[model samples]
Target chain A: MSMTHWQAAFAARIARDEPQWLAPMRAAAMTSFNALGFPTTALEDWNYTSLSSIAEVPFTVGASASSTTVADLTPYMINAEWPTIVLLNGSYSPSLSSLDSIPAGMLVMDLAQATREQPALMQQHFGTVATSEHAMTSMNTGLMQDGVFVHVPKHVESETPIHILHVSDAAAAMSAKFPRTLIVAEAFAKATVLESFVGMADVAYFTNHVAEVVVGEHATITHTKIQRESDLATHVSTTEVHQARNSHYVNFSMAMGSKLSRTNVYTVLDGDGGGVTLNGLYLGKGTQHTDHQTRIEHAQPNCFSRELYKGVLDDASHAVFNGKVYVHPIAQKTDGKQSNHTLLLSPDARIDTKPQLEIFADDVRCTHGATVGRMDEAGLFYMKSRGVPAETARRLLTYAFAADVLETIENETVKQALEQLTLERYAGSGNNTAHAAREH
Target chain B: MLEISNLTATAGEKDILKGINLTVNAGEVHAIMGPNGSGKSTLAQVLAGHPSYEVTGGTVHFEGEDLLELEPEERAHKGVFLAFQYPIEIPGVSNAYFLRSAYNAMRVARGGEEVDPMEFLDVMEEKLKIVEMDDAMLARSVNMGFSGGEKKRNEILQMAVLEPKLAILDETDSGLDIDALRVVAEGVNKLRRPDNAAIVVTHYQRLLNYIIPDFVHVLAGGRIIRSGGKELALELEEKGYDWLLQEALA
Candidate 1:
């Protein structure tokens, strides 16, 4: 389809019953999307990732979400009782969501419901943290229908985490889903939110997702996004965060599926004494292409940011990691460090890692480094000499390379689940070699 | 238990071991004392199937099985171990974890039931004492950030756990303090049995004082130039190898 057709479909989707406040925002975003269109390989950011495959598919848009049952969602759920909110084809499914366990004064509702009931709150923060800088973000903002809206009131610490599950069923094949999530945490509040994107079938589809997070003063938020789409799917997600004074935010993204996937995590430390950590782990196999682009803007003084992304590519897979840390002139005492390391298991596997640091402050301390290497031959031979089979040795070393990123996760339950997944993906071959060793 | 007839090998374009012949019987510890660049370590590596060395001409038999035809892990499973001159560090894999995996792999390959973690821990504790290693070392990454003595001790600890029939110590005494040398030699001495043997390759005879080899061979120019009893090691220690090389040339 051409850009005009995409714009016409967006206009038809927005002509329905949307609030008056969202009308102008949608119009501006639609104009931006029209002007930008789909990014091409000519752009520096998209130079390594091609969108020709995604653009060739005639995706059906503006359709009602396919009906999905609980059985179809069980495979994607990490915790079934964690005040879960499920989105089918980017639209909220009340039959699948279970929000009864949510704490009092903590609001968790669908985006459409929030626009109707909490219009004031939605109007103030929506489309504020995330700008229409990229075509995917603009298209998602203009075309989004329903996603979860979470608001943790001031000083209301949520003990149980909130699970936002996105499942695209078999009926969603040859279609597009734009998922939008906005999370606002009030002052002195603490919460952990996990967003999981999964697909139920082997059909090809496109997922354009955007999430805006606002962290209030002295608040803390732990956000995790796990992208396990179908092997033939295209996934593009952008997480834009704004942190307040003395607030802390950390994001952990794990990408293991999708034939073509790109995730951009951008954060701005707008308040003094704030800190942010963007850590990611990507495992690519079987000709898959995974890209992670992150930027941390230290806009305030006395802020610290750390970013570490590790990738393991096998077979003919390719991975790209581009991370930058930007510090403003007035942001003195800014401590920023970023590094990207990749391990290529096969000679055909490739990785392009670039760690950049742009600092205007003279007194700030910033450092960036990147390394791309193959498996350690000496280490492999050492293991085999100790009686470990060649295949098992490779699995153990691969798992070890990806295990340190799991340490970045603070939640034990989520950490364990991801640990098991990593083990099964890398080390478990009929027998659990590394898992059995860790059982002691 | 082990025989190598006319073994010739090369590393890269250089001949490392040329026309070497040796025989190791059960319950015997043979000391191979050689000068620098004399193929002592190469012989040990070839016996354990180090891929760096290409065996151009050799026939090695271990308990009547063709040792040269097996891979490194298969050689390990058949009770052959080589204590590396410099053990490589494997980050993120704990010492205990590596040992357990290696132990279980050998057991499973031999058609035996795998020992559980608890059972393995019991066996590990017994072997750890032989190397005088603390429990904290077991949890650390293999050979990473370890002291020189600690690395050698870890090698011995593995040998103790694996219980190989033929243990080739390649310069095991290099870069060791007097106390560490004694401890390493004592660990090797304690693990010796009537049915298993060892080949100690070193530059000096200081290690043989504790391990007490039954025979000593002087290797020069990729061949065994001389062979004698353990007293030959002491004589070489006092007289040095210059006279021996001159006598062999004469």
Candidate 2:
């Protein structure tokens, strides 16, 4: 029989001598990944996105990438005082990172080190939070060579945010990179992680990323992910979170550049009185397509979740947002809300939004809605009649649409970075409607 | 310094204003009073170059220049202001930002220096006092969630800030209480200069009590039926608009 596409990639990995126990788990994960394959449009969960373009290319599995420095990551790096873990082509880079300032009682190391040093801990919690329902998660478990792992002990709080940066240096075109991150916070511990994924502007690559978080009782975790890959690159990222009793979880994500990118966030509130907040912003221009999908599961009583996602599309770009919230029967006092808003700046730009709410419990308060709007003509006229120039009005209105959601971000530095990037996007697309009107 | 000769306009092929003639020099406030459906607001809208109103026949001249040829914003840059009856609400744009943008845009068109935010805030605070507005209103979105009186006062505040040559108020007193009417009329009276003129369009004569008009013109059935002194508004208030409608029909 002819071997499948993933089989060859798997064969190349087991060729080297690896950890002893990983052999059986890798075998099982490979079997599941081959069965699942790539999700297609026939599946209702991925109806708006198609993987045909991704499935066509023959991808090379990456081991080592070209040499890069901190200079290549300055654009996407936040200006702050924190310990950062830098990864080049999905592998750890000790030279390009700063680990001297990490706080005490925290275990911040690569997966390989965790597997060797804390063998029992790695055996206990490696795949506990990362699910294997789909191919991407299982594929990462089977073939992921090196990734990031962070653990915060009980009753400790770190003020400085731990930054995990993944910079893709595609030494060879058509190479594929798989990045996995696992974070475990014990009871009453608090930590914040800022994770970013970026690459060169014109490079072509495939990035499959997954992050899983295990939040314990009364523990707090704030995870922010920023995906800004090259326009010729493809990115598929998934985030999974499981919260304990009375724990708190906040997730913020922004998708800026990619030919075809999808960001999926799934959360399960397994304990009572826990809270979840999810906020996202996606910007697409040119022929880029950005998708944001979120699912919040309320399995316990007295839990609450809030989700708001907004998108802006210009040129011939497209965007999609599908958010679902499910409240079980035992979760009677659950409170959940989800809102999706999109603004199309061109006639050819489009968006598809599906907001779903599934509640089996009575006496629960849940609200879900989606809205789509083009530029407001009356608002433009009001600005024009007030003597504001046409182009200025257009830029201001466009900025205001995205700024409304960006203002909700609690991190001041992160908010400013995103705002600058958004302004650059608007300035780059100078042929937008307002400019067209001015030309006429 | 404004002239309208044989001015006619239509909306969707239906004539709304037919054969209107008026003249106003500088240093005057002219009140055009009429009953409902008498096309009182249409004249103010047409003069400001609203796109919905097509000028079928006639000419409007401001400072001896054809005003109809200029865009609405161009007319605004040349010192023409219209206080809308119902101001539109724009969310996510702060009141201070919108005001400064308008001020700077006009200044750029006039080849004058633009005011910085600190300097503009000083100017805005002074104008807000003229319109009896609070400082906190400047931080909120433009006209979003504002009460009826606050919106009207905001319009007057804008008019006060722009300091236009010819200001038109369309039914500015319809939804106002006595206090707001007094504040708005006081603000208007303060803006009058020997070089600028005003046009007040109202359905009632009560607003004339605060700011007296130089001339009272009664309009009926798309035409100005009569013109008199300030006593004309008083006479219409004492009686009703029936006399003017009858006189014009005859």
Top candidate (TM-score)? 1
- Candidate 2 lDDT over A34-86, as tens digits, reads 88777788888889888778775777778455767778767666863578888
Regions more than 4 Å wrong, model 2: A1-3, A15-23, A103-105, A170-172, A427-440, B12-14
RMSD (Cα, Å) of candidate 1?
A: 2.0
Clashing pairs in 2: none
Off by over 4 Å in 1: A62-67, A103-105, A433-440
Model 1, CA-based lDDT = 0.89
Give the per-residue Cα lDDT of candidate 1 at B247.
Answer: 96
Candidate 2 positional error at A318, Å: 1.5
Candidate 2 TM-score, true structure as reference: 0.92
Docking category for candidate 1? medium
